[model samples]
Every structure is written in C-alpha cells, then in structure tokens.
Target: MSAELPQPSTTSLADRVKNILIQPKDEWGRIDAEPATVAGIYKSYVVPLAAIGPVAGLIGMTVFGVRVFGLSYRPSFGATLSTAVAGYIAALIGVYVLAMILNALAPNFGGQKSEVQAMKVAAYSCTASWVAGIFQLIPALAWLAILGLYSLYLLWLGAPRLMRVPQDKAATYTIVTIVAAIVLFFLVGLVASSVTSMFMPRMPLPGGTLSVG
Candidate 1:
C-alpha cells in the first residue's frame, strides 16, 4: 500500500483573510501553493467565515429589528435561530457546490481542472462577501452588504491564477461562475426563508396589525 501524504497545517485564518482581501493578486498563488484538503479548507476557512452572514442576520432581525415599510418589527428568537442555522448550512453547502461547478466547467473555459484548486478559489475569493456579511448586524446598513460584490472582482482576478484560464477566457469563466453563484444564493435564500416561515409564528405589528411573516 502507498503511504498517505501529510497535510500542511492550514494557514492562519487571519493571514489568509487579510491577504485575500488586501492583496488578492498576490494571494492566489500563495493559496494555491498551500497543501490543503477540501475538508480542511471547509473546516478552517468556510465554516467560521460563512457563519458571519447568519449570525449577523440573526442579530439584526431579532435583536436590532428590521424596518419594513417604515415600521419596525423583530423576527422572534425562534425564527431567528432557525434561519441562522439554515443559512449557515446553506452557505457551507453552496461553497462546495460552487467548487464542484468550477472544477467541472474548467475544461470549457480552457482552464486546468483540479478540485482542490477550485475549492481554494471558491472559498477564498468569497472572503469579501463573507466579511461584508457583518453589515447585516445593523438592519439598516444591511443594504451595504452589497459591498460583497467585491468578491466578484476577486474571483475574476484569481481565475487566471488559480484555474489557469487564459487571460482571454478568464473574464468569461468568472462571469459564468458568478451567474451560477447568484442562482445558488437565491435558491439557498428561498429555502432558508421557507424554513424560517414554517417555524415562525404570526408576528404582531404595531397598531393591532398581525403580519403572516
């Protein structure tokens, strides 16, 4: 039997986060050089960062309260809790799925295919959006979460380095991956919302109003 290869200690989350956000052009090669497994990547990178979105959303909707149509209403603690759990799981799974999609489509884009490289690209390139998720802590600034769009640029920049796409084809590959990611986000959001609604009781709005949220 062949001996198993040892995995490198995963890179520090802070350094990885900092470099990816501050100097992505240089970070992709460093990230690709790291010896890591898909499981290690998820455990070390995806889980902690992905939690930012749901945790912040919970705090915003339940603790900070949402302003809908000029009225403030809070999702009950139970709804918030359930949604957070569902959202966290969805985020994790979404990364894995996107990684798979990226790897599968690499040939069409004239990129080299490697599952581990795809996972690295998918997870790290997402750092901006995951960090921007903190904006959800304030219900009003939630719109600022759009800043997460910066991840798209990160993805575009990293595609050539991580996936080995020709510079000519890099933009097309990144754009396609982005469109797929958007669809995945929508599907995950719809499922999390449905799950939340199922557990949520009718919330009472101000002035004797009952909202079937």
Candidate 2:
C-alpha cells in the first residue's frame, strides 16, 4: 500500500478558502497531498461552508426581509430557523451522496476508483459553491451565486490529480458528476420542501393564512 498523504500541521480554514479561490492550482495540489477521512473532511470543511447559505438566508429573510418575485416577503422566524437547519443538513448529505456517485462512476469514466479520494474531491471542489452561497445574505445578489459555476473549473483541474481520471476523460467525468449532483440536489430539495411544508406554520396571505410559497 502507498504511504498516507500527510495532513498539514496547521491548515487555517480562512487560508484554505482563500487559496482554493485565488490559487486553486496550487491549492488543489496541496489538497491532493493532505490525508483526510470522511468524518474529518466534514468537520474541517463541509460542516462550516454548508452553513453559510442557510445561516445567511435565515438572517436575510427573517431579519432584513427580501423581495420574492418583486413582492416584499419575509419568512417567519420559526419558518426561517427550521428551513435553515434542514437546508444545512441537506447540504452536508448532498456532498456525501455526490462523493459516492463520483466514486461509483469513476471506473466507467476511465478513472481509478477510490472512495476516499472521491470524497475529498467532492468536498473541496464544492468550496466555490459554498462560498458563493454567502450571497444568500442579500436576496437581490443571490443570482450572483452563479459564481459556483467556478467549481466546474476547479473539478476539471482536480479530477486527474484527485480522482485519477485520464486527461481526456476528465471533462466527461466532471460533467457526469455535476449532472448527478444537480439531480441529487433537486431530489433532496424536493423532499426537504415537502417535509418542511408539512410542519411549517402557514402565514397570512393576501386573503387568508395559506401554507404556500
């Protein structure tokens, strides 16, 4: 068996986030060298970033309020809190699901299969999107969350080093993984929305209290 990739003695979270955005090539090299476990990766990276969107959304929607399709709206505090917690948990699970899908699909895409490596790629490549999620703080700027598109580039660069995909197969691998992730997320969101709706209190609408979004 090969030697383990050494974990850095002091990898600052802020520095890692900055490096991944500003210096991804070098950053991915560093990430590819670091040893990690599924749980460790969640504690170190996924858990924190996953909260960015929901936390920001909670504050923005509840405290500051925002226009929904040009109509002023604010989710009740209870609704916001429940939604935030549910979304945060969903985000964490989404990463793990994506990692599993990536690992399972690797061999079919001319990539060496390794679940640990796939998890790392799934966790780190998502940094851009999680960071972009902060735009949730300002609903108007939420469209800028499209910046997560940058992750596609990050994944393309990291695939060969992290997932061991051949250069020619990297694009195919990335595209496949991304598509799978989108579908998985959509399903997760649908389920979460359904569940949230079932328990969430209805708010007064133009005419009466109706539980609708």
The candidate scoring highest on lDDT is 1
The alpha-carbon lDDT assigned to residue 142 of candidate 1 equals 86
Tens-digit per-residue lDDT, 48-139, candidate 1:
99999899998877766656666666666776788889989988998898898889888898999998889988898889989999999987
**lDDT, model 1:** 0.82
In the range 167-191, model 2's lDDT, one tens digit per residue, is: 8787888888778877887898797
Candidate that scores best on TM-score: 1
- Report the alpha-carbon TM-score of model 2 versus the true structure: 0.84
Local error of candidate 2 at residue 101 (angstroms): 1.1
Scored by CA lDDT, what does every candidate get? 0.82, 0.79
State every prediction's TM-score relative to the real structure: 0.87, 0.84
